[model samples]
Target: MRFLSRRLVMPNDLNFAGSLFGGRILEWIDEEAYIFASCQLGAKSLVTKHIGAISFETSAFQGDVVEFGLEVKRVGNSSLTITCVVRNKQTKQNICIADDIVFVYINPETRKPEPHGKTKAELDAEVLDI
Candidate 1:
Protein backbone atom coordinates (compact mmCIF):
# COMPACT_ATOMS: atom_id res chain seq x y z
CA MET A 1 0.00 0.00 0.00
CA ARG A 2 1.17 3.49 -0.85
CA PHE A 3 1.05 6.19 1.79
CA LEU A 4 -2.00 8.34 1.13
CA SER A 5 -2.62 10.47 4.17
CA ARG A 6 -1.67 11.11 7.76
CA ARG A 7 -3.42 12.36 10.89
CA LEU A 8 -2.44 13.27 14.38
CA VAL A 9 -4.27 11.57 17.17
CA MET A 10 -6.02 14.28 19.15
CA PRO A 11 -7.63 14.21 22.58
CA ASN A 12 -11.10 14.30 21.09
CA ASP A 13 -10.33 11.21 19.03
CA LEU A 14 -9.58 9.10 22.04
CA ASN A 15 -11.90 6.59 23.63
CA PHE A 16 -12.67 6.20 27.32
CA ALA A 17 -9.50 4.14 27.66
CA GLY A 18 -7.44 7.09 26.44
CA SER A 19 -6.60 5.26 23.23
CA LEU A 20 -7.60 6.04 19.68
CA PHE A 21 -11.16 5.08 18.91
CA GLY A 22 -11.62 2.23 16.44
CA GLY A 23 -14.55 4.01 14.86
CA ARG A 24 -12.42 7.05 14.12
CA ILE A 25 -9.78 4.88 12.52
CA LEU A 26 -12.44 3.19 10.45
CA GLU A 27 -13.73 6.54 9.27
CA TRP A 28 -10.25 7.47 8.08
CA ILE A 29 -9.80 4.15 6.36
CA ASP A 30 -13.12 4.46 4.56
CA GLU A 31 -12.38 7.98 3.44
CA GLU A 32 -8.91 7.06 2.18
CA ALA A 33 -10.24 4.03 0.34
CA TYR A 34 -12.98 6.07 -1.23
CA ILE A 35 -10.51 8.63 -2.49
CA PHE A 36 -8.15 6.00 -3.87
CA ALA A 37 -10.90 4.07 -5.64
CA SER A 38 -12.43 7.21 -7.06
CA CYS A 39 -9.10 8.35 -8.43
CA GLN A 40 -8.33 4.95 -9.91
CA LEU A 41 -11.70 4.68 -11.61
CA GLY A 42 -12.05 8.38 -12.40
CA ALA A 43 -15.55 8.46 -11.01
CA LYS A 44 -16.97 10.14 -7.95
CA SER A 45 -20.36 8.41 -7.96
CA LEU A 46 -19.11 5.50 -5.96
CA VAL A 47 -20.56 3.65 -3.01
CA THR A 48 -18.86 1.44 -0.53
CA LYS A 49 -20.15 -2.06 -1.12
CA HIS A 50 -18.22 -3.93 1.54
CA ILE A 51 -15.25 -3.87 3.91
CA GLY A 52 -13.59 -7.19 4.50
CA ALA A 53 -11.77 -8.46 7.53
CA ILE A 54 -10.07 -5.81 9.65
CA SER A 55 -7.50 -6.47 12.34
CA PHE A 56 -6.20 -4.03 14.91
CA GLU A 57 -2.76 -4.95 16.08
CA THR A 58 -1.97 -1.96 18.22
CA SER A 59 -3.30 1.27 19.66
CA ALA A 60 -2.44 4.95 19.42
CA PHE A 61 -2.48 7.59 22.12
CA GLN A 62 -3.17 11.30 21.85
CA GLY A 63 -0.39 13.23 20.03
CA ASP A 64 0.61 10.15 18.04
CA VAL A 65 0.84 10.66 14.31
CA VAL A 66 -0.62 7.96 12.08
CA GLU A 67 -0.20 7.38 8.39
CA PHE A 68 -2.81 5.77 6.17
CA GLY A 69 -1.71 3.66 3.23
CA LEU A 70 -3.88 2.34 0.42
CA GLU A 71 -3.47 0.25 -2.74
CA VAL A 72 -5.80 -1.04 -5.41
CA LYS A 73 -6.18 -4.79 -4.99
CA ARG A 74 -8.56 -5.62 -7.81
CA VAL A 75 -10.82 -4.08 -10.41
CA GLY A 76 -14.08 -5.69 -11.40
CA ASN A 77 -16.45 -4.55 -14.09
CA SER A 78 -18.25 -2.27 -11.73
CA SER A 79 -16.31 -2.49 -8.49
CA LEU A 80 -12.84 -1.71 -7.17
CA THR A 81 -11.34 -3.50 -4.22
CA ILE A 82 -8.65 -1.77 -2.19
CA THR A 83 -6.51 -2.69 0.79
CA CYS A 84 -5.29 -0.40 3.54
CA VAL A 85 -2.83 -0.25 6.42
CA VAL A 86 -2.46 2.37 9.12
CA ARG A 87 0.59 2.72 11.31
CA ASN A 88 2.16 5.01 13.83
CA LYS A 89 4.50 7.36 12.03
CA GLN A 90 7.09 7.65 14.75
CA THR A 91 7.29 4.07 15.93
CA LYS A 92 6.44 2.45 12.62
CA GLN A 93 4.12 0.14 14.50
CA ASN A 94 1.07 -1.15 12.73
CA ILE A 95 -2.26 0.11 14.01
CA CYS A 96 -4.83 -1.58 11.77
CA ILE A 97 -5.24 -3.44 8.53
CA ALA A 98 -8.22 -3.70 6.19
CA ASP A 99 -7.85 -6.10 3.29
CA ASP A 100 -10.85 -5.68 1.07
CA ILE A 101 -12.72 -2.43 0.83
CA VAL A 102 -14.93 -2.71 -2.22
CA PHE A 103 -16.36 0.34 -3.90
CA VAL A 104 -18.74 0.25 -6.82
CA TYR A 105 -19.21 2.83 -9.51
CA ILE A 106 -22.72 4.14 -9.86
CA ASN A 107 -24.51 6.18 -12.47
CA PRO A 108 -25.79 9.35 -10.88
CA GLU A 109 -28.99 9.42 -12.87
CA THR A 110 -29.73 5.71 -12.72
CA ARG A 111 -28.33 5.32 -9.24
CA LYS A 112 -27.11 1.87 -10.26
CA PRO A 113 -23.77 0.16 -10.61
CA GLU A 114 -21.98 0.91 -13.87
CA PRO A 115 -18.97 -0.63 -15.55
CA HIS A 116 -15.75 1.34 -15.01
CA GLY A 117 -13.57 -0.55 -17.51
CA LYS A 118 -10.38 0.13 -15.59
CA THR A 119 -7.54 -2.31 -15.00
CA LYS A 120 -4.73 -2.45 -12.50
CA ALA A 121 -2.27 -1.46 -15.21
CA GLU A 122 -4.24 1.69 -15.89
CA LEU A 123 -4.30 2.50 -12.20
CA ASP A 124 -0.51 2.13 -12.01
CA ALA A 125 -0.09 4.44 -14.97
CA GLU A 126 -2.31 7.02 -13.36
CA VAL A 127 -0.30 6.88 -10.16
CA LEU A 128 2.90 7.40 -12.11
CA ASP A 129 1.35 10.48 -13.63
CA ILE A 130 0.98 11.97 -10.21
Candidate 2:
Protein backbone atom coordinates (compact mmCIF):
# COMPACT_ATOMS: atom_id res chain seq x y z
CA MET A 1 0.00 0.00 0.00
CA ARG A 2 1.22 3.48 -0.88
CA PHE A 3 0.29 6.21 1.53
CA LEU A 4 -1.12 9.06 -0.55
CA SER A 5 -2.59 11.75 1.66
CA ARG A 6 -2.79 12.92 5.24
CA ARG A 7 -5.52 14.82 7.05
CA LEU A 8 -5.54 16.44 10.44
CA VAL A 9 -8.61 15.65 12.42
CA MET A 10 -10.52 18.83 13.17
CA PRO A 11 -13.19 19.65 15.66
CA ASN A 12 -15.91 19.71 13.02
CA ASP A 13 -14.90 16.23 11.86
CA LEU A 14 -15.77 14.71 15.19
CA ASN A 15 -18.88 12.83 16.17
CA PHE A 16 -21.07 13.71 19.11
CA ALA A 17 -18.93 11.49 21.30
CA GLY A 18 -15.83 13.36 20.01
CA SER A 19 -14.21 10.74 17.78
CA LEU A 20 -13.90 11.15 14.01
CA PHE A 21 -17.16 10.56 12.22
CA GLY A 22 -17.53 7.38 10.17
CA GLY A 23 -19.17 9.23 7.29
CA ARG A 24 -16.36 11.73 7.09
CA ILE A 25 -13.76 8.98 6.93
CA LEU A 26 -15.71 7.22 4.19
CA GLU A 27 -15.88 10.42 2.19
CA TRP A 28 -12.13 10.73 2.41
CA ILE A 29 -11.73 7.11 1.36
CA ASP A 30 -13.89 7.59 -1.71
CA GLU A 31 -11.96 10.66 -2.81
CA GLU A 32 -8.59 9.04 -2.21
CA ALA A 33 -9.56 5.82 -3.96
CA TYR A 34 -11.01 7.70 -6.90
CA ILE A 35 -7.78 9.59 -7.43
CA PHE A 36 -5.77 6.35 -7.22
CA ALA A 37 -7.98 4.61 -9.77
CA SER A 38 -7.86 7.56 -12.14
CA CYS A 39 -4.08 7.58 -12.13
CA GLN A 40 -3.79 3.81 -12.52
CA LEU A 41 -6.19 3.75 -15.48
CA GLY A 42 -4.85 6.95 -16.97
CA ALA A 43 -8.36 8.24 -17.36
CA LYS A 44 -10.42 10.77 -15.47
CA SER A 45 -13.76 9.52 -16.73
CA LEU A 46 -14.43 6.86 -14.16
CA VAL A 47 -17.18 6.02 -11.73
CA THR A 48 -17.08 4.17 -8.48
CA LYS A 49 -18.74 0.83 -9.17
CA HIS A 50 -18.43 -0.87 -5.82
CA ILE A 51 -16.91 -0.77 -2.37
CA GLY A 52 -16.48 -3.92 -0.32
CA ALA A 53 -17.17 -4.31 3.36
CA ILE A 54 -15.59 -1.52 5.42
CA SER A 55 -13.98 -2.44 8.71
CA PHE A 56 -13.45 0.26 11.32
CA GLU A 57 -10.78 -1.05 13.62
CA THR A 58 -10.15 1.99 15.81
CA SER A 59 -11.06 5.57 16.48
CA ALA A 60 -9.34 8.86 15.72
CA PHE A 61 -9.57 11.91 17.92
CA GLN A 62 -9.21 15.58 17.25
CA GLY A 63 -5.60 16.68 16.72
CA ASP A 64 -4.71 13.26 15.36
CA VAL A 65 -3.17 12.98 11.93
CA VAL A 66 -4.47 10.22 9.66
CA GLU A 67 -3.00 8.90 6.45
CA PHE A 68 -4.73 7.21 3.55
CA GLY A 69 -3.03 4.38 1.70
CA LEU A 70 -4.12 2.50 -1.38
CA GLU A 71 -2.95 -0.45 -3.48
CA VAL A 72 -4.16 -1.63 -6.85
CA LYS A 73 -5.49 -5.15 -6.48
CA ARG A 74 -6.74 -5.91 -10.01
CA VAL A 75 -6.82 -4.23 -13.38
CA GLY A 76 -9.52 -5.23 -15.79
CA ASN A 77 -10.42 -4.34 -19.36
CA SER A 78 -12.53 -1.38 -18.22
CA SER A 79 -12.12 -1.26 -14.48
CA LEU A 80 -9.67 -1.31 -11.61
CA THR A 81 -10.04 -2.69 -8.10
CA ILE A 82 -8.09 -1.20 -5.23
CA THR A 83 -7.84 -1.72 -1.50
CA CYS A 84 -7.52 1.04 1.09
CA VAL A 85 -6.24 1.53 4.63
CA VAL A 86 -6.53 4.61 6.79
CA ARG A 87 -4.33 4.76 9.83
CA ASN A 88 -2.98 7.08 12.45
CA LYS A 89 0.09 8.76 11.03
CA GLN A 90 2.08 8.82 14.25
CA THR A 91 1.37 5.42 15.78
CA LYS A 92 0.46 3.53 12.57
CA GLN A 93 -2.69 2.26 14.19
CA ASN A 94 -5.29 1.15 11.70
CA ILE A 95 -8.47 3.18 11.80
CA CYS A 96 -10.31 1.62 8.85
CA ILE A 97 -9.91 -0.73 5.90
CA ALA A 98 -11.79 -1.63 2.78
CA ASP A 99 -10.92 -4.78 0.82
CA ASP A 100 -12.13 -3.67 -2.60
CA ILE A 101 -13.06 -0.42 -4.25
CA VAL A 102 -13.91 -0.84 -7.92
CA PHE A 103 -13.85 1.93 -10.49
CA VAL A 104 -14.94 1.62 -14.11
CA TYR A 105 -13.76 3.75 -16.95
CA ILE A 106 -16.65 5.33 -18.74
CA ASN A 107 -17.49 7.45 -21.75
CA PRO A 108 -18.33 10.91 -20.50
CA GLU A 109 -20.80 11.65 -23.25
CA THR A 110 -22.59 8.33 -23.03
CA ARG A 111 -21.94 7.79 -19.35
CA LYS A 112 -21.29 4.09 -19.95
CA PRO A 113 -18.46 1.79 -19.15
CA GLU A 114 -15.62 1.73 -21.67
CA PRO A 115 -12.20 0.17 -21.96
CA HIS A 116 -9.34 2.14 -20.42
CA GLY A 117 -6.84 0.47 -22.81
CA LYS A 118 -4.15 0.05 -20.18
CA THR A 119 -2.76 -3.09 -18.58
CA LYS A 120 -1.34 -3.86 -15.17
CA ALA A 121 2.15 -3.93 -16.68
CA GLU A 122 1.68 -0.46 -18.07
CA LEU A 123 0.59 0.87 -14.69
CA ASP A 124 3.62 -0.71 -13.05
CA ALA A 125 5.91 0.86 -15.62
CA GLU A 126 4.29 4.22 -15.09
CA VAL A 127 4.99 3.93 -11.39
CA LEU A 128 8.67 3.27 -12.14
CA ASP A 129 8.68 6.38 -14.34
CA ILE A 130 7.85 8.39 -11.26
Candidate 3:
Protein backbone atom coordinates (compact mmCIF):
# COMPACT_ATOMS: atom_id res chain seq x y z
CA MET A 1 0.00 0.00 0.00
CA ARG A 2 1.08 3.56 -0.66
CA PHE A 3 1.16 6.03 2.15
CA LEU A 4 -1.48 8.61 1.24
CA SER A 5 -2.29 11.00 4.07
CA ARG A 6 -1.26 12.00 7.57
CA ARG A 7 -3.17 13.51 10.47
CA LEU A 8 -2.22 14.67 13.92
CA VAL A 9 -4.34 13.42 16.73
CA MET A 10 -5.74 16.31 18.71
CA PRO A 11 -7.63 16.82 21.95
CA ASN A 12 -10.84 17.49 20.05
CA ASP A 13 -10.41 14.19 18.24
CA LEU A 14 -10.31 12.14 21.37
CA ASN A 15 -12.87 9.85 22.91
CA PHE A 16 -13.96 9.84 26.55
CA ALA A 17 -11.06 7.56 27.39
CA GLY A 18 -8.62 10.07 25.87
CA SER A 19 -7.70 7.89 22.96
CA LEU A 20 -8.18 8.64 19.32
CA PHE A 21 -11.80 8.07 18.33
CA GLY A 22 -12.49 5.14 16.07
CA GLY A 23 -15.14 7.13 14.19
CA ARG A 24 -12.67 9.87 13.36
CA ILE A 25 -10.17 7.33 12.16
CA LEU A 26 -12.84 5.79 9.96
CA GLU A 27 -13.51 9.20 8.43
CA TRP A 28 -9.85 9.59 7.63
CA ILE A 29 -9.68 6.18 6.03
CA ASP A 30 -12.75 6.81 3.89
CA GLU A 31 -11.53 10.21 2.79
CA GLU A 32 -8.14 8.89 1.82
CA ALA A 33 -9.71 6.05 -0.10
CA TYR A 34 -12.06 8.39 -1.90
CA ILE A 35 -9.22 10.64 -2.97
CA PHE A 36 -7.18 7.70 -4.21
CA ALA A 37 -10.08 6.16 -6.09
CA SER A 38 -11.03 9.43 -7.72
CA CYS A 39 -7.45 10.09 -8.84
CA GLN A 40 -6.85 6.56 -10.06
CA LEU A 41 -10.09 6.36 -12.04
CA GLY A 42 -9.83 9.96 -13.28
CA ALA A 43 -13.38 10.55 -12.16
CA LYS A 44 -14.94 12.38 -9.25
CA SER A 45 -18.26 10.57 -8.93
CA LEU A 46 -17.38 7.74 -6.63
CA VAL A 47 -19.35 5.99 -3.93
CA THR A 48 -18.14 3.76 -1.15
CA LYS A 49 -19.95 0.48 -1.62
CA HIS A 50 -18.45 -1.70 1.07
CA ILE A 51 -15.81 -2.01 3.77
CA GLY A 52 -14.69 -5.42 4.86
CA ALA A 53 -13.08 -6.69 8.01
CA ILE A 54 -11.36 -3.95 9.95
CA SER A 55 -9.07 -4.93 12.79
CA PHE A 56 -7.60 -2.48 15.26
CA GLU A 57 -4.21 -3.49 16.53
CA THR A 58 -3.41 -0.53 18.75
CA SER A 59 -4.54 2.88 19.86
CA ALA A 60 -3.15 6.38 19.58
CA PHE A 61 -3.31 9.10 22.14
CA GLN A 62 -3.63 12.82 21.60
CA GLY A 63 -0.59 14.28 19.79
CA ASP A 64 0.32 11.12 18.02
CA VAL A 65 0.43 11.39 14.24
CA VAL A 66 -0.99 8.70 12.03
CA GLU A 67 -0.44 7.86 8.39
CA PHE A 68 -3.02 6.21 6.16
CA GLY A 69 -1.76 3.88 3.50
CA LEU A 70 -3.83 2.47 0.64
CA GLU A 71 -3.34 0.21 -2.34
CA VAL A 72 -5.53 -0.93 -5.17
CA LYS A 73 -6.41 -4.56 -4.61
CA ARG A 74 -8.71 -5.06 -7.56
CA VAL A 75 -10.60 -3.18 -10.26
CA GLY A 76 -13.87 -4.41 -11.57
CA ASN A 77 -15.92 -3.01 -14.44
CA SER A 78 -17.36 -0.35 -12.21
CA SER A 79 -15.81 -0.94 -8.81
CA LEU A 80 -12.41 -0.52 -7.24
CA THR A 81 -11.30 -2.46 -4.19
CA ILE A 82 -8.67 -0.97 -1.91
CA THR A 83 -6.77 -2.23 1.11
CA CYS A 84 -5.79 0.13 3.92
CA VAL A 85 -3.38 0.27 6.83
CA VAL A 86 -2.81 3.03 9.34
CA ARG A 87 0.28 3.38 11.47
CA ASN A 88 1.59 5.65 14.17
CA LYS A 89 4.21 7.91 12.66
CA GLN A 90 6.32 8.29 15.77
CA THR A 91 6.34 4.67 16.90
CA LYS A 92 6.02 3.14 13.44
CA GLN A 93 3.47 0.69 14.76
CA ASN A 94 0.39 -0.36 12.88
CA ILE A 95 -2.73 1.00 14.48
CA CYS A 96 -5.32 -0.62 12.22
CA ILE A 97 -5.70 -2.56 9.03
CA ALA A 98 -8.68 -3.16 6.74
CA ASP A 99 -9.20 -5.04 3.55
CA ASP A 100 -12.07 -5.15 1.05
CA ILE A 101 -13.07 -1.54 0.70
CA VAL A 102 -15.00 -1.18 -2.52
CA PHE A 103 -15.74 2.05 -4.34
CA VAL A 104 -17.89 2.27 -7.41
CA TYR A 105 -17.85 4.84 -10.17
CA ILE A 106 -21.17 6.54 -10.76
CA ASN A 107 -22.65 8.66 -13.48
CA PRO A 108 -23.95 11.89 -12.06
CA GLU A 109 -26.95 12.15 -14.33
CA THR A 110 -27.86 8.52 -14.30
CA ARG A 111 -26.93 7.87 -10.71
CA LYS A 112 -25.78 4.46 -11.73
CA PRO A 113 -22.52 2.61 -11.76
CA GLU A 114 -20.21 3.37 -14.67
CA PRO A 115 -17.11 1.67 -15.87
CA HIS A 116 -13.76 3.06 -14.73
CA GLY A 117 -11.80 1.04 -17.27
CA LYS A 118 -8.73 0.56 -15.09
CA THR A 119 -6.77 -2.39 -13.78
CA LYS A 120 -4.04 -2.84 -11.22
CA ALA A 121 -1.63 -3.98 -13.88
CA GLU A 122 -2.38 -0.89 -15.96
CA LEU A 123 -1.78 1.36 -12.99
CA ASP A 124 1.47 -0.41 -12.21
CA ALA A 125 2.59 0.00 -15.79
CA GLU A 126 1.75 3.66 -15.72
CA VAL A 127 3.90 4.10 -12.65
CA LEU A 128 6.76 2.20 -14.22
CA ASP A 129 6.36 4.06 -17.50
CA ILE A 130 6.68 7.30 -15.64
Candidate 4:
Protein backbone atom coordinates (compact mmCIF):
# COMPACT_ATOMS: atom_id res chain seq x y z
CA MET A 1 0.00 0.00 0.00
CA ARG A 2 1.14 3.57 -0.71
CA PHE A 3 0.44 5.96 2.11
CA LEU A 4 -0.47 9.60 1.51
CA SER A 5 0.00 11.08 4.88
CA ARG A 6 -1.14 14.19 6.76
CA ARG A 7 -3.41 16.19 4.56
CA LEU A 8 -4.28 18.77 7.13
CA VAL A 9 -7.90 19.85 7.26
CA MET A 10 -8.36 23.48 6.41
CA PRO A 11 -11.18 25.92 7.19
CA ASN A 12 -12.37 25.67 3.62
CA ASP A 13 -12.61 21.93 4.02
CA LEU A 14 -15.34 22.26 6.61
CA ASN A 15 -19.11 22.41 6.37
CA PHE A 16 -21.35 25.04 7.94
CA ALA A 17 -21.30 22.97 11.11
CA GLY A 18 -17.48 23.14 11.17
CA SER A 19 -16.90 19.51 10.35
CA LEU A 20 -14.69 18.58 7.43
CA PHE A 21 -16.70 18.11 4.28
CA GLY A 22 -16.84 14.66 2.77
CA GLY A 23 -16.23 15.89 -0.74
CA ARG A 24 -12.85 17.38 0.09
CA ILE A 25 -11.59 14.15 1.57
CA LEU A 26 -13.15 12.17 -1.24
CA GLU A 27 -11.31 14.22 -3.81
CA TRP A 28 -8.07 13.61 -1.97
CA ILE A 29 -8.73 9.88 -2.12
CA ASP A 30 -8.97 9.84 -5.88
CA GLU A 31 -5.99 12.15 -6.28
CA GLU A 32 -3.76 10.22 -3.94
CA ALA A 33 -4.81 6.88 -5.37
CA TYR A 34 -4.00 8.06 -8.83
CA ILE A 35 -0.53 9.19 -7.77
CA PHE A 36 0.15 5.91 -6.05
CA ALA A 37 -1.12 3.84 -8.94
CA SER A 38 0.74 5.88 -11.50
CA CYS A 39 3.96 5.38 -9.59
CA GLN A 40 3.26 1.67 -9.45
CA LEU A 41 2.51 1.49 -13.17
CA GLY A 42 5.63 3.54 -13.98
CA ALA A 43 3.33 5.44 -16.27
CA LYS A 44 4.64 8.64 -17.72
CA SER A 45 1.30 10.12 -16.72
CA LEU A 46 -2.21 9.05 -15.69
CA VAL A 47 -5.69 10.46 -15.46
CA THR A 48 -8.75 9.47 -13.54
CA LYS A 49 -11.32 7.83 -15.76
CA HIS A 50 -13.77 6.52 -13.18
CA ILE A 51 -14.69 6.76 -9.54
CA GLY A 52 -16.37 3.70 -8.10
CA ALA A 53 -18.52 3.29 -4.99
CA ILE A 54 -17.51 5.21 -1.87
CA SER A 55 -18.34 5.25 1.81
CA PHE A 56 -17.38 7.71 4.59
CA GLU A 57 -17.52 6.22 8.06
CA THR A 58 -16.40 9.12 10.24
CA SER A 59 -16.14 12.83 10.62
CA ALA A 60 -13.01 14.98 10.52
CA PHE A 61 -13.36 18.42 11.92
CA GLN A 62 -11.06 21.40 11.38
CA GLY A 63 -7.41 20.84 12.34
CA ASP A 64 -7.59 17.11 11.80
CA VAL A 65 -4.79 15.50 9.88
CA VAL A 66 -6.14 12.82 7.60
CA GLU A 67 -4.12 9.95 6.22
CA PHE A 68 -5.12 8.14 3.08
CA GLY A 69 -3.48 4.97 1.89
CA LEU A 70 -3.72 3.70 -1.65
CA GLU A 71 -3.38 0.19 -2.99
CA VAL A 72 -3.92 -1.45 -6.34
CA LYS A 73 -6.72 -3.96 -6.03
CA ARG A 74 -7.00 -5.21 -9.58
CA VAL A 75 -5.56 -4.53 -12.98
CA GLY A 76 -7.39 -4.95 -16.25
CA ASN A 77 -6.29 -4.71 -19.83
CA SER A 78 -6.35 -0.94 -19.80
CA SER A 79 -7.78 0.12 -16.46
CA LEU A 80 -6.53 -0.12 -12.88
CA THR A 81 -8.64 -0.11 -9.74
CA ILE A 82 -6.98 1.82 -6.91
CA THR A 83 -8.41 1.56 -3.44
CA CYS A 84 -7.91 4.29 -0.84
CA VAL A 85 -8.31 4.01 2.91
CA VAL A 86 -8.77 7.21 4.90
CA ARG A 87 -7.79 7.42 8.52
CA ASN A 88 -7.73 10.07 11.25
CA LYS A 89 -4.19 10.86 12.29
CA GLN A 90 -5.17 12.84 15.37
CA THR A 91 -7.21 10.17 17.06
CA LYS A 92 -5.06 7.43 15.63
CA GLN A 93 -8.32 5.69 14.75
CA ASN A 94 -9.44 4.33 11.45
CA ILE A 95 -12.29 6.01 9.67
CA CYS A 96 -12.57 3.34 7.01
CA ILE A 97 -13.20 5.87 4.26
CA ALA A 98 -12.81 4.03 1.00
CA ASP A 99 -13.22 4.38 -2.77
CA ASP A 100 -12.23 2.50 -5.88
CA ILE A 101 -10.78 4.91 -8.40
CA VAL A 102 -9.75 3.91 -11.89
CA PHE A 103 -7.01 5.61 -13.83
CA VAL A 104 -5.73 5.10 -17.37
CA TYR A 105 -2.32 6.23 -18.42
CA ILE A 106 -2.24 8.12 -21.64
CA ASN A 107 0.31 8.37 -24.35
CA PRO A 108 1.12 12.09 -24.32
CA GLU A 109 0.99 12.23 -28.09
CA THR A 110 -1.87 9.88 -28.86
CA ARG A 111 -3.74 10.58 -25.59
CA LYS A 112 -4.43 6.90 -25.11
CA PRO A 113 -3.85 4.35 -22.41
CA GLU A 114 -0.32 3.04 -22.63
CA PRO A 115 1.38 0.47 -20.49
CA HIS A 116 4.42 1.72 -18.54
CA GLY A 117 5.89 0.26 -15.37
CA LYS A 118 6.71 -3.46 -15.19
CA THR A 119 8.55 -3.93 -11.91
CA LYS A 120 8.01 -7.27 -10.23
CA ALA A 121 7.25 -5.76 -6.80
CA GLU A 122 4.63 -3.37 -8.10
CA LEU A 123 3.04 -6.08 -10.21
CA ASP A 124 2.79 -8.39 -7.22
CA ALA A 125 1.22 -6.13 -4.63
CA GLU A 126 -2.25 -7.18 -3.43
CA VAL A 127 -4.89 -5.05 -1.81
CA LEU A 128 -4.83 -5.48 1.91
CA ASP A 129 -8.17 -6.26 3.61
CA ILE A 130 -7.74 -3.25 5.90
Residue-pair clash count for candidate 1: 0
lDDT of 4 at 60: 85
Against the correct fold, how does model 2 do in TM-score? 0.95
lDDT of 3: 0.90
Q: Write down the lDDT that model 1 would get.
A: 0.93
Q: What is the TM-score of each predicted model, taking all chains together?
A: 0.96, 0.95, 0.95, 0.82
Candidate 4, residues 1-130, lDDT tens digits: the string is: 5566668889999988898787787777777787787766767477888888787677888888888877777777666777888888868666655666888778889987776545334577432322
For all candidates in order, the CA lDDT equals 0.93, 0.92, 0.90, 0.74
Model 4, C-alpha of 83: deviation from truth (Å):
0.6
Q: Ten residues in a row with the worst lDDT in model 2?
A: 119-128
Pairs that collide in candidate 2 are: none
Ranking by TM-score: 1, 2, 3, 4
2 or 4, greater by TM-score:
2
* Deviation of model 1 at 74, angstroms: 0.5
Write down the worst ten-residue block by lDDT for model 1.
35-44
Q: Can you tell me which runs of candidate 3 are displaced by over 4 Å? A: none
